[model samples]
Target: MVTQTPAWVLNDQQGIESLQLADNPVSTPKDDEVLVKVHAASLNYRDIVIAKGEPQLPFFTPGVTPCSDGSGTVTAVGSKVKSFKAGDRVCTHLVSGLSSSSAPTFTDINSGLGQHLDGTLRKHAIFHESALVPMPPSLSFLEACTLTCSGLTAWNALFGLDGLVPGEGTTVLVQGTGGVSIAALQFAIAAGSTVIATTSTEAKAERLRSLGAHHVINYRTSRDWGDVAKSLTHGRGVDIVVDVGGLSTLPQSFKAVRTNGLIAVTGLLGHAEDQAAVPTILECLINACTARGILLGTRDQFHAMNRFIEDKGIKPVVDEEVFDFLEAKEAYRYLEQQKHFSKVCIQLE
Candidate 1:
């Protein structure tokens, strides 16, 4: 008997309204590919933007499966594949396992799954061997799903700095309670850095603190969170700032970072409208700080980050809600609200 996979698909060129769950046949893996029976997939702001008419790749259409990060068991592998076999639990790297640059950050996303190629909002997905990372035994599929995109972005932002050592009293500022920032807090704190986290809601501040954030600032109430950050750092400013909250927050991030500090810019959910902040960013750079733009990360980096997580037993910060594959759209909606604390996951059979 043939199996069918139900996937949340965006079939129109306009908006999220066009997204629908459709039952499609499962695919066969190519010679260098393996089929993952995706167990849990997570949502990001990118999915929301892409669902609302932003093309994943240039000249790409609207109707593709939508989400990059997922964890699953290997159900099948092609003849040429040797690293994995049936029943192996795994997650895919953010890219298609291809390298475009040598820098720790700024790797080109050429054939991204979920954006241009088909993604893991379905029961199964076929990807290259290099895309797969072995899941740590300590993580459930739900927890493992968080690592691919959010975890990697946070890891790259904090640990990817050139001259910065892991320990030795470094301070890092993370904005918002979104997946990446939350993960950044966990990672930085674990690595012996002082973590300052910001949230719009006072209620979430406690949660952030609980997640190892040394200090929590309510961005809505505090007009100058940067000053608070500076004060926390004894007026020296933090060593790194995970500037996920784009242009609106970059100025504050500029003020928050120490001289020669690194500001790793990831998400622009807050700057979707005005992307041209280069002049202001340059001013910040001239002040003896480095601002690095980040996409997800390479497969090699993903492995290295996973190794750290495994060795440290650092679990991901997951929210209370878990949706099944059929309810992926609902999960995406909740992620957009930014009400949830950590990663939002969809469980696929």
Candidate 2:
């Protein structure tokens, strides 16, 4: 399905204040496409970069809608759309969806959803059947929307690469309470891995513990939080460290992950640090561990993650305040401000 939708156009790529929304039109699906009645859309750091015309990405289509992560119901399907049907629950994936074993290339991301193509931020959107995944049953549309990006990135970090899926006796280190970190914490716990999370406040630390983190370290107080995480593991170090803070936090993350362990570089939050300086290979070599940069996941991995979520009854954590469709700019701004605990979303009825 397709339509001339007056969606949330990223006008001029100036900033969040430029997001424009309209109900637009909903058309029937094409032979290989599926029409979706988008129920919800979530924001990611990449979305903000595109909306604000940040240099993180080399190309930005200014007129396109600015979000790739969404959850919706299939309203119609083309004759050739076999994987999805009318009334089925679904979510959007990067447009050029990858194979199960395929690693994403820079070109793939360059031509992906919310990048080269129009995104899934509208009330009604038509996507190629291959670019949609069945939503995890245990999650509502709001929660499912998050799985498109941050959730999938976390899943890929924990289980996707090198066949290192965290299980019993695995110790995971998560930094902050952002979407990726929180998702990693939840998925690790579900897989029976002990998790150690770092946050700024005791209040947030308590919330982390409530979410099943075995140890919560206040990074503000414990300046050497990497050593703290290592001590928590009795000097063996965590098996996996999901590092959201890039330049500022990588040193500690290096200290946290054990030798030959994995450090998933999912996000770079706070300030303009992510835009400028990044962790160097020298640091990784000195730390004696691999630091892998994650860029979401493939369609097959998305399905696998969804199955695990449904089987474990995992529900993504969304911010308490959800926005209406008209508040698209507000949602982007909220996520830009980094005030939310996990995901910030707009709900469309």
Candidate 3:
């Protein structure tokens, strides 16, 4: 067993450039925890935010390791551990001990792996048994690591609330080719729902089609792409709109959904701008759709999503570029530039 491991730490500077690779002590797991030999860790938008020390996160522990989503093999288990043994493959849940059905509170958010607590950027990490779920059978460590955040959030958006399961004859509209949107597209198609995706370029549009999207809308060329999306659905509008662009795109999302349809507000990727002439809330009222915010998901949702991915042979889309563990800062910059197709990952070994 190794006594030390290489890990990336976000020093007091708080930015991609601030990440430092250091040799850190690796301790044995505690009575209720297991030590894992991490194989890969993946990036999410939130990881970047935390690395920069966002002021809103009052409880963020500075100089802590960063990254929430990871996949690893259990190397050792404490005496009290029972559900897992050495050599079992697992993926992390963002929060350390989340098992509740409700959305996370501020306290829960403070305990997130990459924020208030030490995260999985290290080559080895110790986690409570409840913080992990069995790895999906069909994916490699690189692909499985992404399920910890993006895949689970997409699942929660579509199936986590209101018992609304999208399947045959249902329609889902996903925004852009980011991690969560791409994940949602994959899950919806696997469950037999027709998907309409929006992207800026024809290149990404082709990729979306090849991934089983029924139609692709170029949001750049057509400012009113929402009307185009509705037209593709025969003026009936879509059943769900996975809205990642917050206020800048909410008006279009409202225009794209059917009456009482759902718009899952997954991210605020858009900048402040005059997107439309009307008030955003009025658009929701006019469209008669429910728009709610998403904050990743819970441990139980992570487990259920893993099972669904395994059962359907769905592998979350990972970017072609794989970074070495030492290149974590570069990975963060690449993701910040918004060039990757979906998830960006770094290998530990």
lDDT digits (tens) for residues 195-220 of candidate 1: 88888887788888878888988988
lDDT by residue (1-349, candidate 3, tens digit) is: 7789888887764577778888888888888898999999999888877767666453567768888899999999888988899999999887766554556665776677888677889998888887788898778999989888788889989987775568999899999998899999999999999999999999999999999999998998989988999999899999889988886888788888999888898887776477455346666777777887788787777778888887898978999999998889899999999989989999987
Model 2, residue 139: distance off in Å is: 1.7
Q: If ranked by lDDT, best first, what sequence of candidates would result?
A: 3, 2, 1
* Better candidate by TM-score, 2 or 3: 3
Candidate 3: residue 186 lDDT (0-100): 98
**Number of the top TM-score candidate:** 3
Measured by lDDT, the strongest candidate is 3
**TM-score between model 3 and native:** 0.95
Computed on alpha carbons, the lDDT of every model, listed in order, comes to 0.79, 0.84, 0.85
lDDT digits (tens) for residues 260-308 of candidate 2: 8899888766443353444579877877888888878788888899999
Reference-based TM-score of each model:
0.92, 0.93, 0.95
Best-to-worst ranking by TM-score? 3, 2, 1
